[model samples]
Target: MMRRRTTLLASCTALALALGATACGGGGPVTAGGGDKALSGQTVTVAGVWSGSEQKNFQKVLEAFSEKTGAKTQFVSTGDNVSTVVGSKIEGGNAPDVVMVPQVGVLKQFAEKGWLKPLSKTTRQSVDANYANVWKTYGSVDGTLYGLYFKAAHKSTVWYSPDALAQAGVKPPTTYDQMLKAGHTVSDSGLAAFSVAGQDGWTLTDWFENIYLSQAGPEKYDALAAHRLKWTDVSVVRALTTLGKLFKDGQLIAGGQKEALNTDFPGSVEKVFGPEPEAGMVYEGDFVAGVAKDQFGRTIGQDANFFPFPAVDGGEAPVVSGGDAAVVLKDGKNQKAATRLLEYLATPEAAAVWAEAGGFLSPNKNLDLASYGDDVTRATAKSLVDAGDSVRFDMSDQAPAAFGGTKGAGEWKLLQDFLRDPSDPKATAAGLEAAAAKAYRG
Candidate 1:
């Protein structure tokens, strides 16, 4: 089953209009405290998986918080293993005051361990006003609110270069079969149809998630995510089989599977959008637009544009997404200051900071659409907010860390192996089931 709610777009529109008018009067950066500087002399520490540009952009949000409340903020990068990093910090009695958890399963683990502090009533109220209920549900554990989601990813977009597509004489496909046919047609022009990032196993998981959600529908998708349905179920086999159609086709993938397996995530985007393009299209989240622009110097709406991932087997298209949640640690010394930062994070003001910097999407419905840096970014953010509770979170993020988040083991490795040799979807399904069983049971 899926979470259902009255669509949030109407309320979001009204709030945006109100906020927009106030924002136009003053051109200063918006802050949650209205420049009260009430938090001077307090220091709050935060940890998360963000690094490089993402880390830089988040720092700007913290800068705004400091400006508003005069609280000093410190950020630590936890890399990809957020649970392990945070757990070690807690054990050493030096835990950060707050952490931006990357997975819902990890957030629940923290809350269940009594390591997370229940959010303040003020923070909860802010969340209720600005976000759809589903986001709050994901941030809650056992119906107790503990976290606030700040960043979201639209995982169903397929990005392409307009020049390349026009030269190939093919429009974006609306169905799976049409996508494949168009891929072949593009290949016939001596260009690879798709640039796949096989080196990053997480990308493989996203690819499978979109196909699974669309072809099998949300019930099976949720079952498979929770491990209530085995990965070896026919649904998984079917999704894997469908994915193999693209993975196994060497001509359709740029530089063949071998090259794809060697290319990292950003490299895959560069292959398509770079000056001398290696492929015509790439499949990833809306973040691809950021990479295309910042790393490759391409324009968003002009040189880079995306279509919703096509329907699979004539099924309705699905919206699969991922987000990071901000939570407070119960044992932290700076509880007051940390809670203050979280309250700010729940506001449209904090969300707008990263949104204007590009490569960011906020679930806060009260955030003005004009806050987005570009039209493409605005459209993608609206679709994500519009999907509301109908959106399915990234499947791997819902599974235990040992199974879903690890690099060389579990789903990541299994999918990478599958990409290396995609001839047997049944065998891949079996491997996935075994790994999932061990992880879930543990």
Candidate 2:
């Protein structure tokens, strides 16, 4: 996870996925050989929204790639609005050689516009050897692979403090009803039942997606992602109402919707596990473990731990995943170097580097799980792989950006409104449906 973890990324075969420590050297303009990866000295420009420590770690990985290929890699921080910055760059004919795209919807949009270059044959084979078919489908648009998923996150985990739960005499819930029961118990114990990242609208969307996917099933999830299912549908209403139970009296949550709305992602976790804990649990991806460890200086798997999001409606267990995808742009001045970078990223070695760094997970099945830094990290990675065919990608990510990734104009805004006052699930569903209609139209 890039800390922000607004994430998804991915490819290569025959060439070893294992790598040694990155070597040091200088890179500049040099002639390319006719052989594959003919990149000797070429500057490949890569852009992403990652910053702070997350960006620094990724830079280490890029530096490692540079060591092996003699290609100078420049990393650009795209801020929070990667779409706006990258779009402007593309329009101005300055698209970076390789860009880390966060959502599958946007990647497909890029592919449709012919702005992306397909992965080379070796890169394609590498992807095939490393990731599952579902992951392969994520990078493919119209039967052509346009992106590689590099960093994946398990969204179904619920982080909690055992001491707090024990104080409330509550065990981790295994079902939605059981969760609400536990919530009531915690509230009775005068502690928060949940800490939400309402300020960042994306987190609210994730809340809806997880419950919707776990309860309503994948077919419905796909329908919603494709915009074929209206948000006002019965299943949608049911999902919202179920979540509403936790938000109802403001007694179960650390901060009411108002406070939650003002709290950022990391702040959301801080409310739960901070020195003076205000909440007993937080529902987020595995990245929260990294945030807890890094920002708040807490010991994960001890002070904080996670469990699978409980089931709802007796449906299948939930395993929602999202990550950053790397795409080679057609406008990339150094396509060969960019392709080589993708080859390196697809290997287990690259995933291992980031996984050991914390707050990150890779879907690379071939990577040895032992490389993970801790038991919690290994558990998160293993959870995703064990999900197999039952896994579902982030629903909003698969939708049009206007409906998925937009901060204030689409699902994000609608979900925030729903969080503020979840009294009317039907109204919330209608609002979401109305927004989806407008977003899908153009």
Candidate 3:
């Protein structure tokens, strides 16, 4: 979907509001309580939307940093709506030393407001050596670097239940046309063809983006993300028209448009793997495997399989993705400690911790492929790297937060409407262009 789990931040003022208020957080430098390392009394606080098992797994990486640097670290799970929660923290003069921004849009927005801390010289050198220029590009705003993409997800994948596909007597579609044919065949076999999470407009947006990228190529995709190309452009029209082929047909979707609109991401996945499976396939990132495994207790490669989202324009498989970047604040409570954390994350060793945990991917090109959790993840990682420059970040996350991140607003609203009834591509285009224009005007 969008940046399924992402980050956000706000601006900060130099003045500390009171007579003698230090920058960012309330505490002084917090080093090891037992006084173990060279630096004493320094604890760096990290805030993000990560929690539960993801939080528990990430703790291992944090502990690794603590062991290596003797700098105590506390991770604050911000829960859902990171922008709202983290923005409040910053405004309240308690911004964490380092904040994770999930998408380039929020990272750039935070940097644009001068809230992020620039990477230290030592940390910079480590990231430079470990990551590719493309991954690095997402972390930098203009010419200054502020974030590091630590975790990544490959969005250009379609998950299918092999038994369902076989019963339908159709293989996964190799081409866009073949995809539609497979859908029809699956329907003919008395199964819904697609399980779309229409409740989350971003998933629908992703569908359009994948089709557009394959059909229009990367240049147009980038232009659109930068608003260099208007939503009213023929490229967008073509993509929407192509989307219409499936979305317009109610029988093709599980429970039709109404049910699709009500089905959330997890529910959409459940449609394929649940007891009374509703659909044969769902298009999502590799993370969905974790969803299947954890929620339904299904064996991924056995019960479910995936292929790169089939090419729509007779082009290569479209691979769109989302990733999390670690952006340190310039006025962080403990710059040294935060820098140490970033340095650890930049290394291949830390990546391997989460890698083996499954459902995690790193854009660090230096990391070995074997570090991935499973054969499926390895293949997905390879496809991601192989896509190379062909890869594009999720489009909505690149748009204004009001339009992209906010629920019941802008693209999310209009696209929900479009999916409800997609015959009128021109109207949908006009609505999209209008909302985008208003949001971008800010």
TM-score ranking, high to low: 1, 2, 3
Clashing pairs in 3: 7-102, 29-41, 30-41, 30-42, 30-43, 31-41, 31-42, 117-328, 117-329, 117-330
Model 1 clash count equals 0
- Taking the tens digit of each residue's C-alpha lDDT, what string does model 1 give over 346-381? 777788899988889998876778889889999999
Question: Which stretches in model 2 have alpha-carbon errors above 4 Å?
Answer: 1-13, 16-38
Per-candidate TM equals 0.93, 0.91, 0.89
Predicted model with the maximum lDDT:
1
What tens-digit string does per-residue lDDT give for candidate 3 at 7-124? Answer: 0000001111110122322121112122135334679899887776678778877775666556678999976466677778888878788887776777878888888877766556
Cα error of candidate 2 at position 308, Å: 0.6
Tell me the TM-score of model 3. Answer: 0.89
Candidate 3 wrong stretches, greater than 4 Å: 1-41
Positional deviation of residue 349's Cα in model 2 after best superposition, in angstroms: 1.4
Q: Where does the lowest 10-residue lDDT sum fall in candidate 3?
A: 4-13
- The true-versus-predicted C-alpha distance at residue 347 of model 3, in Å, is 1.1
- What TM-score does prediction 2 earn? 0.91
Write model 2 residue lDDT over 23-136, tens digit each, in one string.
311121111121233455689999997888889888877866766667788999998677788889988999899989888888888888888998877667767766788988
The full ranking of all candidates by lDDT, starting with the best, is 1, 2, 3
Tell me how far the alpha carbon of residue 376 in candidate 3 is from the true structure, in angstroms, after superposition.
0.6
